[model samples]
Target: MRTVVYLVIGVFFGIVLFKSEAASWFRIYEMFQFGSFHMYGIIGSAVGLGIVIVQFIKRYKVRSFFGDKIVILSKEKSFYRYMIGGIIFGLGWALAGACPGPMFVLLGAGYLPIVIVIIASILGTFLYGLFRDKLPH
Candidate 1:
């Protein structure tokens, strides 16, 4: 089943996150504190790979599993808007000790305290959705 495949893939991704220490709060703290390059290396590698993958997809006209055309949207060039968003995201990451993606991974890896982060993240998302239409584009 497609659901089973997705589940297995997610579990494998979580294992990778755990093995790479990307889900470690200490690693995240080190990143925020300039204590280590471990997390940065991981993130940089991911971003680099993402660039390559997107290029490949665009060149080859890749599609989703169900065959929808893949499209990479152009980023907005508003510097102040992006700066404000990044600052908000960075502050949350610092306070929570992990970003949104790793919150689920950390929770799955037996860090029960991540539940609070997960809940807050969900609430934040809900509030964002509620105000999305009213916010500036």
Candidate 2:
């Protein structure tokens, strides 16, 4: 079933995150402190791969398995809005010691304390959805 496939893929991704120590709080701390380049290398590689994937998708007109076209939306450019959002996100990441993706991985890895971060993330997302229309474009 599709759900099973999705679960398998997610588990595989979590394993990769764990193996690469991308889900490690110490690695994230080191990144912020400039104490090590390990996490930076991983993040940089991911960004590079993402750029290539985006280009490939655009060039090849990639479609979903369900036959739907994959559309990437272009948003209005707003410097202040981006700066504010990035500041908030960075603060949350620093405080929680984990971003959303790695927070879930940490939870799966038996860090029960990550539930607080997960709940806060969900609440933050909900609040954003409620207020996004009222915010600047």
Candidate 3:
């Protein structure tokens, strides 16, 4: 039941992403080219929708899909750690030109280069897990 709902939502978004050409590395790269507005528009729409949904959740105390209140973790308030993590994330994104979600899509689209990004992302995640408790904030 819950799995079916998840699968359906996933498949729906997968189809939308595929049909919109959002899963293509070339399309994503072209978006950074200043001349193309397609990618920018897609991203803008996503951001706008996310903002609206977040506002609704904040205002209404909406139950999440899992029937629980969505937890926003803010216990870790160390600015330095967050800054370092953000810098690392930005550097990886800039170098790879694809985020984790898009990297999988790129791989499916026959972009072999994304394998490096996937490997690095996995390694980063493993390293973070190894040190998260020990790391300050």
lDDT of each: 0.89, 0.93, 0.79
The model with the greater TM-score, 1 or 2, is 2
Worst 10-residue lDDT window for candidate 1 reads: 76-85
State every prediction's TM-score relative to the real structure.
0.90, 0.93, 0.72
Candidate whose lDDT is highest: 2
Model 2 ranges with Cα > 4 A deviation: none
- Cα RMSD (Å) between model 2 and the true structure? 1.3
For candidate 1, write residues 74-95 as lDDT tens digits.
Answer: 8869777688779988999999
Clashing pairs in 3: none
| Better candidate by TM-score, 1 or 3 | 1
Question: Per-residue lDDT tens digits of candidate 2, residues 3-119?
Answer: 987899899999999899999999999999999999999999999999999999999999977788999877889999999999999999999999888898999999999998999
lDDT of 2: 0.93
Clashing pairs in 2: none
Q: Per-residue alpha-carbon lDDT of model 3 for 82-128, expressed as tens digits?
A: 89988888677667887676777677667797888899899989999
Sort all candidates by lDDT, best to worst: 2, 1, 3
Off by over 4 Å in 3: 73-83, 109-113, 133-137
Give candidate 3's error at residue 125 in angstroms: 0.8
